[model samples]
Target: MKKLNCLIGAIIKDQNWAVIPFGNTILEPDDQVIIVTIPENASKIREMLEGGPVRTNHIMEE
Candidate 1:
């Protein structure tokens, strides 16, 4: 199994536009998120979050 460390945050949508809150934010309806996840489970995580891929430069060593 792989471990992913992600900063789970949220975003809001309004009038065909989207916004992401900053600092000590709370989740709201239509809020999106920015998260970091492992490459293997990235796709599934994205689907769950209703978002897209997270950019990563590090890989896990076994």
Candidate 2:
């Protein structure tokens, strides 16, 4: 999530398991994730996460 300026704090899988996320973690199709980000970026991040088009040209270059 470095690209989106957010961190994935944890992931809950199948209503029975919770896993802390790491840089190399891979999310499953039905897994629920917890993301931590600033309020300013929430909508953009949501758009990206939901498979909507994001205008990367507007992203601030870190």
- Residue runs of model 2 more than 4 Å from their true location after superposition: 1-5, 14-25, 51-62
What is candidate 1's lDDT per residue for 1-53, written digit by digit as tens?
A: 12223433333245343333333344444343444445665665444444323
Superposed Cα deviation of residue 62, candidate 1 (Å): 16
CA lDDT, every model vs. true structure: 0.39, 0.50
Error of 2 at 23 (Å): 4.9
Positional deviation of 23 in candidate 1, in angstroms? Answer: 20
Residue 13 displacement (Å), model 1: 11
Give lDDT: candidate 1, residue 59: 27
Q: Candidate 1 at 1: error in angstroms?
A: 27
Quote each prediction's TM-score. Answer: 0.30, 0.44
Residues 1-62 of candidate 2 have per-residue lDDT tens digits of 32333544555555664654544454555546666555676676567667523222222322
Over all chains combined, what TM-score does candidate 2 have? 0.44
Q: lDDT for model 1, on a 0 to 1 scale?
A: 0.39
